[model samples]
Target chain A: MAATSFQRILVALDGSDCSFRALDFACHIAKQYPGCTLVLVHVIDQRALETARMVHLQPMVEEIVRTLHAAGESLLAEAEAVPKRHQVSATTHLEQGIIAQRLLACAKEQGCDLIVIGSHGRTGLQRVLLGSVAHAVAQLAPEMVLIVREGAAASAGA
Target chain B: MLERILVPIDGSPPAAKATTLAIEVATRFKAEVRLVFVVDDSIHVLAEPSYVQPDYTFFADKMREEGEQVLAAAAKRFKDAGVKVTTQLRNGYVPAEIGASVKEFKTTLILMGTHGRTGWDRLVLGSVAQGVLATTDVPILLVRP
Candidate 1:
């Protein structure tokens, strides 16, 4: 058997500290493989904008699109910064729809062999919801999932 | 006497891959392997046709014999590769019996092919792998086909 090669990796970024740590973890793993490809996916959950549509009464649909694009670019920029700290190649994308669905679809489309994601994103809810987007990706995706917990890397480093 | 490992015979290539890995590990570790075939009871379920005459004891026996043949044939691969091996037969859940034998023989580790066989094959045939993994904290390496 050949050494386990992580050829393609998908990193989910939502501009949260946990998401950034996940990106850092992905970069660390990516450097171990000879020709690994890292993909950064920022999901724009359109459902969140539904409530704002009622209050503003204007064309919230267009506003939602603009906000999503801006967030995607910012998230992608943050992801790019981490890979530059190491020696690895990366690609970035902006996805729309249900957060988990879009993230899974992106992995399939990108042909990622593994997915590294935060256990919880902006919402650090540890109760009722056993999993965040990362946990869902781990369960639903055909590939291996690396659910990075907060402070895992730093503690590992220590 | 086994610094090496022995894997029982199942035709599943996925399980075979686990055996191959076991062989490599054994070779590297300088361990001798003994291949054992357990005449697991579930062979009856795997042998019967969907609409056959209900009684399966006779058919199950015949299937057990066939399983022994598979084990014997599988043992040859190791011998040919110049790896040391031995064979044995047992009757029970493949995993439970295998785990018991592993302890009895003082086997180092158990390697298995997870064919994910279910239903009667699963009911009578518990996952030898899962059983070993659960019961004995000893290492179990599962190969996915």
Candidate 2:
């Protein structure tokens, strides 16, 4: 059997600490396989903007959406820097939609063989209310899914 | 750096797919593949009284034998592919055994298959993969058949 090679790796970045950690891990993996490209993705969740519009004035909602778009762009910029620093080739994607659905669709569209994500590790009431995007992607994605925890790299070192 | 990859098989079709993926990963990383077959005797012990009863030891022994067969077949595939492979048989709950094996073997990654259970069935039975995710700190690579 030929060894599984992840030619194109799709990593979800949301500017969270854990998400950066996942990017670091993905970069390391990309370095291992020669010519592997890391695709950095950040989704501007439209549902969140919709919720803001429902609870706020039109002008306020527009301002919030602008802020969100700016944040997403900066997050993608930061993610791109990680791979650049490591000398790994990468591309950035800014998307809009449900976070998990967009992520799955992007991975398929990009022809990514692997999807790397960070788990928030939420529990109890908060988890039920917020739900886990990583969990949903892991359960549904056609490609292999790698769910990186907060301290996964450190734990692996020890 | 992944040094040891743990994969649990139960003689299911999904398990076969997981094994294939695990071997591919191990071969790429030059990591050892540890194949574990968990003989979950708890299911038998917890069965309804209406269920047929056999000697506990007899049932366990038979399960162990079957598990060994499953492990051997999986091990051969890895060995044939030139990946260093080891096999073990554990007697206990599936998720618990998988977690224990991860710690005992110092596994760097766990590559396992999921049956993709959803809706009411998922809530009622719960998923072993989800249980492992909650209990273990090791990184998991979940593959669907």
Candidate 3:
């Protein structure tokens, strides 16, 4: 069998420490295969915005959305450092939607062969097999899904 | 840096697809492959031996035979790809057995197919991939083949 390459990988980052660990795995894969590229996508969940709108007035909701979008952008920018540290070429995307759906859609839109995400992210329930986003993407992603557990890379190397 | 890759097979199409990917990955990365076929002894577990003395042993033996065949076929594929490989024929709860073997093998990566049940059926059956994902701390390459 010929070697199967992960040509383009989409990584979902949520500005969480674990998400950065997922980025580490994606970078490792990118470096493993020559010419492989990375697509870093951070989604601003619309559901959070909806909840804000429900609880607050329109002006307050707009302010929250703006702040969330800014946070997402900064998260992507921070995540970009991992690929750069590895000298891998990557593209960044900031989008708004349901967290898991938007990540899958980004994978489809970017034509990524693999989708990588942390096992859990910010606000995840402790001791859960997967955070809700990881569970949904693992079940529903169109392309291959790589659910990266935190500290797995270190264990693999050791 | 994938040092050891674990592959679980059950002779399904997606399992074949996953094995193919595992072979390719092992070959490229020089990773050792630990291939396992777990004879899901759910029947034996659910029906205790002292309860009814059903002929479940016959079915368990048959399943073991099938598991061996599947394991050998997949191991052969990996061997042909010039990958270092080992095979195991285990009988027990499938997911739990896999989790145990992951620790036994010191597996770094798990590559397996999504047990293709969508919608309500998927919810009902509960996937092995999901179970293993839940129990293990390794990175899982879940292929929906």
Candidate 4:
């Protein structure tokens, strides 16, 4: 039997309430494992950028891209607080691309054994449109994937 | 705050891996655990399209025996870990039965195995992982093989 250790965890955040919910669970779990490293990441959606480029002129497109990157950085920065409160230190990364794929690549690069992520709580109609990042990551990732939903956390109250 | 844990076992290698992970987590958190085996309802539908309708009694009896064996094997593993565990066997669609257990047990966490491999492997556990995600809002820890 292999002794499993969740030594390295990658938490994917998208600045949604659900993502923060995921961060909460990640922090809670990382707190249990001594020397466990937390890597926080927020990827700017590439599809969003494509839409911006198509709908605007070159100057506006460039402006939107910059704003997107800036927003991503701030999102990661903001997410850092939750881990700190849990007494867990985390490194944050802001990357622009496909959200789920980039998160999985980072997990591979970091040698992470676990990937903690949150699915948007809106499950019914939203699922029809396809492309939920958490679901995609869960499907694609070889590492262990934890899909945290609203009210699923221990701290969550009904 | 990890109060209760639910593990759905299918006797796959990934399921074994997930069970191992579940033991570790359940031990660490000192949480209650429910080991459930769901006999997928598809067996009844599949029995159709045959020249002869297979004995319904045989299918039910055979599936019950299989489900119990799966649950008992998993239960022993958890018991060996010094974690107290309860076993549950249900007959229904895999994901929906699991979702029902999550609600009935007030499960705080779910540990499951996803084969994510091709053909039969994918259908056995991989699709169930995705199916559970779609049906329930609970946090699921999916161990892949």
Scored by TM-score, the top model is 3
Instruction: Fill in the DockQ of model 4.
Output: 0.52
RMSD of each: 9.5, 3.3, 2.5, 3.2
Query: lDDT for every model?
Result: 0.65, 0.80, 0.83, 0.79
User: What would you estimate as the lDDT of candidate 3?
Assistant: 0.83
The alpha-carbon interface RMSD of model 3 comes to: 2.8
Please state the CAPRI-style docking class of candidate 2: medium
- For candidate 2, state the interface root-mean-square deviation in angstroms to 1 decimal: 3.9
Which one wins on lDDT? 3
Query: What CAPRI grade goes to candidate 1?
Result: incorrect
TM-score of chain A of 1: 0.87
Task: Kindly list the per-residue Cα lDDT of model 1 for residues A107-136, writing each as its tens digit.
Answer: 899998778777568764754222467546
Ranking by lDDT: 3, 2, 4, 1
Ranking by TM-score: 3, 4, 2, 1
Task: List candidate 1 segments past 4 Å from native.
Answer: A54-58, A128-130, A153-158, B1-145
Q: In candidate 4, residue B32 scores what lDDT?
A: 87
Error in Å for residue A13 of model 4: 1.1
Per residue, candidate 3 scores C-alpha lDDT tens digits across B4-24 of 999988888888988988887
User: How many angstroms is residue A38 displaced in model 1 relative to the true structure, after the best TM-score fit?
Assistant: 0.3
Single out the weakest 10-residue window by summed lDDT for candidate 4 chain B: B116-125
Q: Candidate 3: which stretches are off by over 4 Å?
A: A2-4, A150-158, B45-54, B116-126
In model 4, how large is the Cα lDDT of residue B103? 81
